[model samples]
Target chain A: MTDSINATGADGGLGGFFQNLTDSIISQIPFWQDVLLPALWDGLWVTMQLVVMTAPLGFLLGLLIAVSRVYGSAPVKWLAQLYVIFFRGCPLLVLLFILYFGLPSVGIVLGSFMSALVGFILCNSAYNSEYLRGALQSIKRGQLLAARSLGMTKMQGVMYVVVPQALRRALPGVSNEFIYLIKYSSLAYVVAVIELTGAAKIIASKYFMYFEAFAAVGIFYLVIVTIATIGIHRLEMKYAIPGVSGAVGKVSKGH
Target chain B: MFESISAVTNSAGYLLEGVGVTLLLVGLSLLIGFVCGIILTLGQVYGPRFARWFVGIYVWFFRGLPNIVLLFLFYFALFPFMGLDLPAFGVAVVVLGLRSAAYQSQIFRGAIQSLSEGQMLAARSLGMTKWQAIRSIILPQSLRLSLPGWANEYPVLLTDSSVAYVIGVAELLTRTSQVISRTGEPMILYLTCAIVFILLNYGGMMIIQYVEKKVRIPGFGNNEAECL
Candidate 1:
């Protein structure tokens, strides 16, 4: 896209070469205004808000559902199962549409951003509950017996004994779901919530620079996921139970 | 309400066509993803370090990026940059397939890892090569074991294929949007679309469950708790 004398371009040496390259790329495209700097910055902020707002809330909702499904009475368990089935089976985009478009027909209205958040919260909670349910199942039955023997109430035992351990065991799976939440948050853009992917689309269509725009967006996600992966690994180590798979080899004592 | 019902019925042909496209996307992508997944699993588990690193990056990118972003990237940028100019349907298949491969590879890798190492060792001591052991001994069992996890991928890809509509792939969601624009009854149309997806998902899961039950090993992987 650029036509110039390459030999004459970087007269200032190695530093000049990079500088010229940056200048050429900038000149060739309105990189800052359209693609790279401000666009991604604003998009990143929105994306952060989406993840930050959704992750904890979703996890708590999921934890509640998981607990209910595992520990609730017959009617409660059936209700939980139905909720999981509906949310889990419906595609996120379709759910967003139903929330944003379908709900308004019934006198319930949500703005575009709120609609996305609600949909994501529902979807996330379903999957998160599945993960937590697995963790709950893995715990031994004796745990509840011990808590009861210790005179703790049913809620107290679940809260003080069972949940802490289940949470630790569930950390890896929960983090995996959190990573999924990060990616699916991009779907918010579908309902006109200008998150990262939405911003890239706007810029890409505006400038016809799909490669640069999406590539930058891709890099942004890659960095976030990579960091999350490492963080999850560290958390696993920190919280690893002695006999669990992720724990280091047990120490030995010599006579 | 009557007009809305008639509108949906009138557009039923178009919606069915969209369903066909959606199924084609899911089917072809699953096939491609399965093959690539096998190759990736072997590479990550049995191949050299460099091969593992390459597959690692492949999985990382595809898994990390949202489906819509990847759809746009392939449909708009990468294919055009390479001068491929492939059809939207084909592009959707490849992108979705590759993304599925990333997840599928992990599923396979887990299955392969669960196979007892002594099986391969015994095969090799019986004069079979590594590849032969993998082909004859390991893969047969692991592939069966992988079926349960792989079955879960169906619903995942089914949901993900909805993103292909963003690139004008004319899938179910896209058709519903078109129908909505025409009928001005988004509630009914979108709910219909949702019900269709739920039906498709549950139907696929039922088939997978049948296969899983028929082929399941008696002592291992039968416990629903561990399978999860």
Candidate 2:
């Protein structure tokens, strides 16, 4: 009984709690040193790969959707609208699941990585199309008329005049979408692509240092998002027209 | 596809059961999320500098991390330390609600900020206390203005609720996947889930549109029509 009391005195005191806290923090360092850093780099690489592949594809798809909505026949326009609404309305996570799990059974198996990439591209395009369409509409009808009066063909006018201006005006919204896409890519883990968040989860499970592992992942995301924000701001400044720069300048400045 | 439909219909009851769980998750999370949102908004807009900073970090952490990661962190990491036992539904609600608060705070902050300063000044000139002025004037207008954003966020929350499936919440998509795994009819089950999701989203949007039509400022769009 005396020995039991002595052991309890050592174990069940403030010192024990402090010791455990110190151990938790100490155990986390090796996790950061060995597993966290490599996983972070791998995750960052995969995230960049998704972004690079999807951005252009998503933009092209968005451009096509915008053109179809604006210039195509009524049925085509209706179809475009339906596509945007359905995709934008549903969550990307659900879309990812359908592509990864649902489509395979139909004998339409997309490799897991491709499934995540394609799903993200489709959803991002749907959203980007809406922003592009809105930006296109916001450009005055006078601009198109002015281009036509300059003896440019309809296609030439759109390519040379309307698109360049619309893209500039759409930069802020597109940048916002890019930030969203970066964070959204984390959802790829659900479909088992072993992206950053997935990598963090594996490390956390392995080390039992969930706080440190996930906190590192969060810090990495914050750095990327912050950098993206600054880069987009610079791009916005470079492309902004003189007179209409005020509103765009204001929003970006506040950020 | 036809074979897939027959398989899906066979498991319709199970899928509906999943939908029930999804709805419950959405309802409970939204309730808790909205309350947290209001408190956070109040803190950012009216509290001391330190309070604002604290709230800002809360929003940043929750919003920056992915929902799945957040769910895992809470369920696996925090729950064990707290030693408070809760079921899967409780954990789902807490995680989703906490994340939703971060997003809703930004939405509310933007709505509140959009109100003209003159109105608040006018209320102050009439001897109303700051809180009184906000309660009587600012909040009413801000709430109406925020309805559209809030409407959009509902479907977002609904779709996000699917993360609950990972933690075994048995939501719609999870149940549908289970059915497909059992019957080997993925096409129909997945398509049904997608269609049901689309319908729910559209339904929410329609309600928002109705509210928007009711509350729209009468003179706002008149200038565009005149210019046209």
Candidate 3:
């Protein structure tokens, strides 16, 4: 009934035909106008915060763990290994549930956002550590020896000579991990953080505009990922070492 | 501790059923991914410019977006728009599989790239067509090379399957959440789910690692293999 009426309203004009089509499509997904889009923007903001906070902290933790694993005493190595295994083996959702829901049972209560952050940091750090460890190991022993010959102690050798090169080599992998964080940060919604995906789910259900709502969310992620991909490419070129095979090679080595 | 054990026992059947769903989801998706991934890899490596561009855009969208968002998009939007009334389980499998295809394609592309171009040239010189060269010469070695990296995907897919719970796929995480709600034992239930997932993660990885070991050419790419 409404379809024919709208078609007739087009008045045999091309402009009206396109306008009619747009209006009909928009009418069916009316929630797009006042509700879901705004919710998604808010969710995008939360997602951004999660990624920003988690990236630096996670990278720092990963670097510490990796260094300890590579150069620490036996106990330190054992502890770092355990941390990596535990965090890496656990599914992120389960880890988040443990942090947000389970911990309160044992008198450690974290709010949803904090729980999501902690879970992300732990998981992110463990994976990042793996990459860093691989990079650390790939550095030639001659570099360390050269540092030692220069009157530097083992710690200083690592800190000055080894770590700089390792970090430089590790940039590609680290940035790849950061891109993953941008996507995985959507899981924050599971713990009630109301990030982008969560916002889409709520609006989709509330307004039954599943197609438009989720499509908009997908666009948001696509935009972030495009930016990340370009940024990572630039970083790879900037940090590229002659004869090192560059970003894709180094990053893929992490996996 | 005894009470916690009892709670686990009480829900053991449901949890096992959940594991079945998880495996079903993972297995089907991995199958779909393997098929689609190969096509995508081939497209990127040897196809014409248009095909390569198509593959690039497909991989970019699938890889760039979050799995959860992709899952939601498929489960809620795409299928419904297409007038398909598939169950949540079906939607989960398709979404995970397609998303995985993107990553798997990259893995396969790397493996294919590691191969020397001489193989294809040799195949062509031997009077083989381009398609024949790919099928006979290029694929076997690259497929073998892809195994080690491909094995890594198992754990990744397993971890990602937990997100299916958002759409009520009744997987392991969903089952554990249900048990927690009923028994008010979030810690034990959640821990049990974690242990199960970890077991799957490590166990699956170990099996794939074994396959990799069997298929590996000893001196072909040992340095790279060890680094990975």
Candidate 4:
């Protein structure tokens, strides 16, 4: 066990605890500067790379699956449903292990990074399809009927009318998936891809400074998610209809 | 590969032993989480402002943080500071249980909030104390509403129990990995683990469906009908 000092005082407690905590944090700075800092940099790069590559691909694939499930012919719809259930029911880690290990056996060898990317995209697509499907379903049937009555073909109606509304509605959920994707990308480390958590584990093991290493990782995630939240908020505001602002404001206030 | 399958067949008892530990971790953690969830849900629904704030912070921290990171912190960082030297399994149970509790609280809170205010008011009007009203009325209704969500949470917990591998808990995933490393047939071993997880999730969902069907009030067949 370590020292159990009560840094907080009964009266005027702020200064003492602040100083002690500051000292504790500062004492760990060298460890970070030498080892953990570099690992963090590498981890951040890998995580960002995964996010940038996977988000759009996964989103588009999910959109397709959602559309197929909702608007496609019977066979297509069944296939989409099966895809969603199979991927959604299983964990991402298992999916990753299967892709990384199982594929190589059948003469389908893939590089580690590619395997991780494919696994992530597949899993994310399934989860995203569920969200997008719900969003798509939420669009009033009357809206689609109106587009159809306006001389638009089924594809044209969906592309021009249904999709825009569904996309707007799906933004919040997609943003949630994006945040989850960032965290889930850490699982890539199990396959020896040195993402943020993996980097932290390595540094922590090497330096025996688990506190500083993990705290740094947490801060990185918090900052990224906060930025993402603010960015998505702005996007929501920009696309929101003028009259809908009042409704959105009321709903948010209720929450 | 054939040899490895033969090995598995011969060591079926040993493999079962490992599965037992995995189930133990999942079962114990889920049980602890359910109990903690109920308490936290009550706190959120009826407790003072400070209690609500505390519970809010707890849920935010647990949900936002990665479980593996938290497990590491609990095992390597927090345990030493707390002056307790718990074993790997103990650490896995506490960490997973606490994390699951945070998630379960949200589920329970959502279920409780879905109940109409009129029901609580009616119960109180009937001369019931606040706790009495909650115990006699709210809890039963909330439990019913929460079952489906709780069912989903079970599979989530099962999937996440793999995090116990980080702390050397020797769960299914860890054992599978160990077997693969030794036998060099990663495909077979890992695939087996994945199939097992899929079956577990499907089985859990089936059980939830059964429970929901059995306990559903007469004429309230659909979930939304019950909610209404």
Candidate 5:
């Protein structure tokens, strides 16, 4: 494809090289407009839907698990702790395969989308809970004790005094996990859900233009991640209560 | 599930071989990532303004894209077009390593930054060149501080190595699926696969923790030590 352009650039200087590269890229604009843009637009909608549906559910599940781990009675605490370990230990793609592929054998089949949704929520919440747990632990014991001494029930004290501050402190780590969710949500494709990466794969193989297709897809992912990160930063700043320090040194990363 | 026990047993050798390949992928990539990470960290930390900007963009580009897409880009397109014919496994290793380097640099940067400025100055005052100062003073402490975060890259990379399965690399997950199709017992087989991964996960962490204690300077690391 660019071999001809490369041959011409070989005889020319850097300016000519850049010119040829731009010329080739500019020539492809019509094809990208007519072909890649429309398919990618639809796939993006599916991806956005996945993020919108999963984020809150995962965060809510995360809060429950974190709370239970920090405050629940014996068995409940152990179970919640175990849940975090189990899901966090499992690779999300394999978990998706098990849910989407293996579940039929147990006579509980979920659609591809549902399977991905369940898998992501499980994995996402586990990591989120880890962050939440740290935040919960970082809350001063005096706050909870004070709330209880004020005639507040254990649940009421935790709900009112401890959790709000902890969530604020954990906001950075939680939002970091949120960004990981968006990137890895591309894994949904392995189970046959045609989201963003899946759409790119389909188009690449169809057109036999692997480079163009994947490069364009990379741009799509990069743009969305950039936007999401900026948005999260804004939200984090807005919620930054003056005294609650978002702790440093938390290892919030993704595979 | 019971009958398929033999199938797994028979391919226990195959599966072990798969585990070896998986380890090789993670091992080699992490090694490469570690090397690249150090360079990128130095670039960001001590290099000029342009270098910092370049490192910033590199990290953003690699970290922001999904692993699978990076695999697709390099494997299907970039490598072949450039006329180098690395196997899917090699390409996977390289992509994973380079992507990992971005994450690793940040880990190293954080570690390097955590050291007091006085240490660098002390090394400089002792007639040490910048490289000598870094090698003798900066790296010793920062690498230790960087361990927990750096060790974390193991599990992350281990899980991500599964993405190489998409390229048909005959890794553990690929072998597991092959055995799954043969045995027709997805639950047992997949569960087995999950257990193996979890074992691999903590097992690696155990070694890392051992090294952490082994190399730990007395009265060093963690917040309490930082105040001193």
Candidate 6:
């Protein structure tokens, strides 16, 4: 078992099938380790960069949109709503295309990386704002009033009191969105950003090992998604309160 | 603004034609998804340990990969290796269908699980076999309960179908880009496609909402209890 198995060309039986599988897999190990891993690692780095750059800005912009929707004038609320509807309605691929290919005609050409960044932020923020807005609304107005009565300004109340609770409530949804972002960021390749899937695609075409290349890419994503899921679950547990609305009380509502 | 408006010309009916392909892609995938979803749900809820294990793996594999990657995998690898030689459009539909099944199965599982064991017990006591009990007692209410979540799938699938353009499916997004290449109206053309997509999103939701309203069994529903 320590050495690589090379059962060559056994045919016909179930045992032969296993032997062929062993030989094929042994042959693939060198190709996978030497060729696939290095290219995919580079692609994964770009993918991570896309996710990292997009998430915080997207989170902050989503917060602004959520706040405006919750606490702004009538026109301001409408504008935020319109923004979410338009941005969320357009698929990310189309949005990226609009930024990359479409914008040059109107003289606002973004390079591939920049186009992908802007497009992901726009799409991400819209959904994030929706989740945040829901969480924001779920907070009772009495808390805001109480903060104001305690000599805090309206902005101060929101900054100090309301936002913390809303964020906790929004955590599940936002983390869910973050998972989606990791998956959807693959679309950046459509705009010519050579991210993980892009890297896999190039190697796959060059070697005609589409299954191996793409399956490796899938493994990379599953690992990323599983790690994110575990991390998010831990965050949820760390912040879990004894008697919170989104946290505890809903969990016991079984039939 | 007027001159710009006049300059905003489109490829006559070509993009509109894509709307049909897009709908067909989603429609076919979702139809297959619905049937397969029911099977997956049944396995998850009622089948033995091995069946449940198989369903879990199916859902996990489909859900873990991104849309474009799966499309490329099937188009370039799976179909070719199996000697199926499905057209790219066929491959797109199969991938989307399998993916949608994974999501929709969860919706059905949640709906079915939300119903208490009391119903099954009652059906058993009344001389109904397990299969009959499920057919008559369980499915009716659970299917209705799953409507809102199932309806949410339309928009999800619609958005996903746009990814088919990567493999040249002649979908709305693909056609919109074609129009843009010829007319150079990226802003106007893309904007129109966005609006069309938005309308499709809301329009389909509106119909689902109508069906939901029509199927209301008063005092037998949870209000906006999100399954996902």
Model 2 TM: 0.88
Q: Indicate which candidate wins on TM-score.
A: 5
TM-score of each: 0.90, 0.88, 0.92, 0.86, 0.94, 0.91
Candidate whose lDDT is highest: 5
- Please give the distance, in angstroms, between residue A213's alpha carbon in candidate 5 and its true position after superposition: 1.1
Which runs of model 3 end up more than 4 angstroms from their true locations?
Answer: A1-33, A241-255, B226-228
Error of 1 at A219 (Å): 0.5
Two-chain DockQ for each candidate model: 0.38, 0.42, 0.53, 0.29, 0.53, 0.42
- The Cα error of candidate 4 at residue A51, in Å, is 1.9
Comparing 2 with 6 on TM-score, the higher-scoring candidate is 6
Across B1-228, the per-residue lDDT of candidate 3 in tens digits comes to 898889999999999999999988999999999999999999999999998999999998888788888888888877765557889999999989988898889988988898888998999999999999999888888888777667777888888999998889999999889988888889989988998898887787777776677777777654344222
lDDT values for all models: 0.83, 0.76, 0.84, 0.77, 0.87, 0.83
| lDDT string, candidate 1, B51-110, tens digits | 999999998889888888888888887777555779999999999899888888998998
Model 4 per-residue lDDT tens digits across residues A1-255: 122234333222555445644677878777768778888999999989988899999999999999999999999999999897677666677778888887887788876788889988998888788767877877789888999999999899998988888877777777777877877787787777888888998888887877677878877876786687688788888888753221100000000
Error of 1 at B176 (Å): 0.6
Q: Give the alpha carbon lDDT tens digit for every residue of A148-233 in model 6.
A: 99999999999998888888888887887788889999999898899999999999989887878887899999899889889989
**Quality class of the docking in candidate 5, CAPRI style:** medium
What order do you get sorting by TM-score, best first? Answer: 5, 3, 6, 1, 2, 4
Off by over 4 Å in 1: A1-30, A33-35, A244-255, B220-222, B225-228
How far does residue A54 in candidate 4 sit from its true spot (Å)? Answer: 1.6
Residue-pair clashes per prediction, in order, are 0, 0, 0, 0, 0, 0
Q: When superposed on Cα atoms, how far off is each prediction in RMSD?
A: 6.8, 4.8, 4.3, 5.2, 3.2, 4.9
Please write out the lDDT profile of model 5 over residues B63-137, one tens digit for every residue. 999999999999997776555689999999999999999999999999999999999999999999999999989
Error of 1 at A155 (Å): 1.6
Q: Candidate 3, residues A1-255: lDDT per residue as tens digits?
A: 888766655453455545644774767665666787789999999999999999999999999999999999999999999898888888899999999999999999999999999999999999888878887888899999998998999999999878877887778778888888999999998898999989998888887878777888999889998998898888788877786534322433111
Local accuracy of candidate 2 as per-residue lDDT tens digits, A1-255: 888656644664444445555677786777677778898789889888888888889988988898788877899999999898778766677788778877776678998799989988998888778667767767778888999998989898888877777777777777777877887888887788888888887888787777667767877888887788789899889878875432221111000
Question: Which window of ten consecutive residues has the lowest lDDT sum in model 2 chain A?
Answer: A246-255
